[model samples]
Target: MLNIRLASSMVSGVAGELLAAEAQTHHLRSTCSTSVSTLSSLESELESLLSKTHAIDGVTNQISSLALDTRILSLNATIEAAHAGEAGAGFAVVANAVRDLSRETAKATSTIFDHLQAVLSAVDRVQKVHEQLREQMLELDRESGVLAVRVKEQGEIVSTAVRFVDEAIDAATTPCAQAQNAPPASDTYALAPADDDYALAPADDDYGLAPVGDDYGLAPVDDDYGLAPVDEDDPYALASDEADEPPDSESMDDPYALEAV
Candidate 1:
């Protein structure tokens, strides 16, 4: 029983470790799954971001094209003003202002285009990184699934071992349990019932004679050596008597009478 108990303890210990490992593996798998989902969401959001960046880049290009068109229009107006000589003088001032405005617009558009390009480049880099992370998440999810399977298998094995150990312990202790619970066998060494006389000897007061008292054959006392007998009518026959007259003090004076009383 002791050996079986020890073995069961060891099996229970192993089972506990396996259960803990199983729980840890399950938690890790859940983490992997959540990470994978997050990565997928990030990928979709990154695509949307890239799309918006591309749209902004296209808008910047359109702005730059519009600025170029304005520059061309301003150049044409300046040429027309030059052709008009003195009439062209005030118009030339207007044409110069339009040309300067167009130049500034073009410079601003170029700056916007450079910023948009940088933004698009950043979006592309982010998309690439997101793809890599998504792949890693998928791999980790797969590995976690495998680990969960292995952990489940190990847990089952440990559980089966624990069950077997328990059964074995039960089997090992069965005889002892039965022996403890079984009625004791008729004792071969115990003395058998003796003769009727032997059994009746103790009831007959074998140790000594029966106690002697009034209930036995003892005779009642009738005399106190030489003293007079107490009268049944004596007032002081008992102190509890209601009669007030006391017995003769001379009769009580006898020591033998006092002894009898």
Candidate 2:
């Protein structure tokens, strides 16, 4: 019984540990799932940014074209101002200022193009990195899910083992409990109901003799033998009955009784 109890305790402890492990695995799976989702979202945002960057690249090209058109218009104005001579000196000064402004605009637009290209390149690299991270996170999520399932399976196995141990403990302890609670063998037998035949039988050793006034199919007793007489038709009873017969009358008178007479 003690051994069974010890086994039960051990099984229960193992089952508890299995359950705890299952819970931890479940938590890890959840974390992995969430991380996968977050990475996926980040990848999607990166994709959106990449798309917007492409659109910005188109806009930047249009700005560069506008700067080239402005520079051309400034050059045409400067040529017209040179044709006007001294009367267009003030106009020539304004034209030179406009041409300088156009040149600066062109330089600024070129710088912006270079920076935008770098940004686009960086965005592409970032998108690729994000894709790799997303893939890794997804893989981790799947592995964690499998691990959680295995842990749960182990928990179930532990539960089954615990149940088996509990049943064994019950089986082992039941007999002892019954033995402790039940009556002793002697008392149990003594308290058993008596047979009706034995209960009705006479206490004395009357053999098969019927009472003097009774006629309940029982045989009558012989006066000398004090037992029922043997039946003539019963072959088995004749020899035993003769052997058990009382002695003759002469044998009944003792030597002491003859002396007295």
Among these predicted structures, which one has the highest TM-score? 1
User: Residues 18-133, candidate 2, lDDT per residue (tens digit)?
Assistant: 88887887788788788878877887887888888788878878887887787788788888888988888888788778778878877887888898899889988988888888
Which residues of candidate 2, in runs, are more than 4 Å off? 187-261
Candidate 1 per-residue lDDT, tens place, 1-261, comes to 787788889878988988898888889888888888888888888888888878887887888888788888888888999999989988888888888888888899889888878887888898888888888878887887898888889889988988998888788789889999999786443433323323322343334233433233233444333223345445233232232343466656755454333
Evaluate model 1: give its TM-score. Answer: 0.68
Listed in order, each prediction's TM-score against the native is 0.68, 0.67
lDDT of 1: 0.72
- Quantify all predictions' global Cα lDDT against the true fold: 0.72, 0.69
What RMSD, rounded to one decimal, does every model reach? Answer: 18.9, 9.6
> What clash count does candidate 1 reach?
0
The deviation in Å at residue 149 for candidate 1 is: 0.6
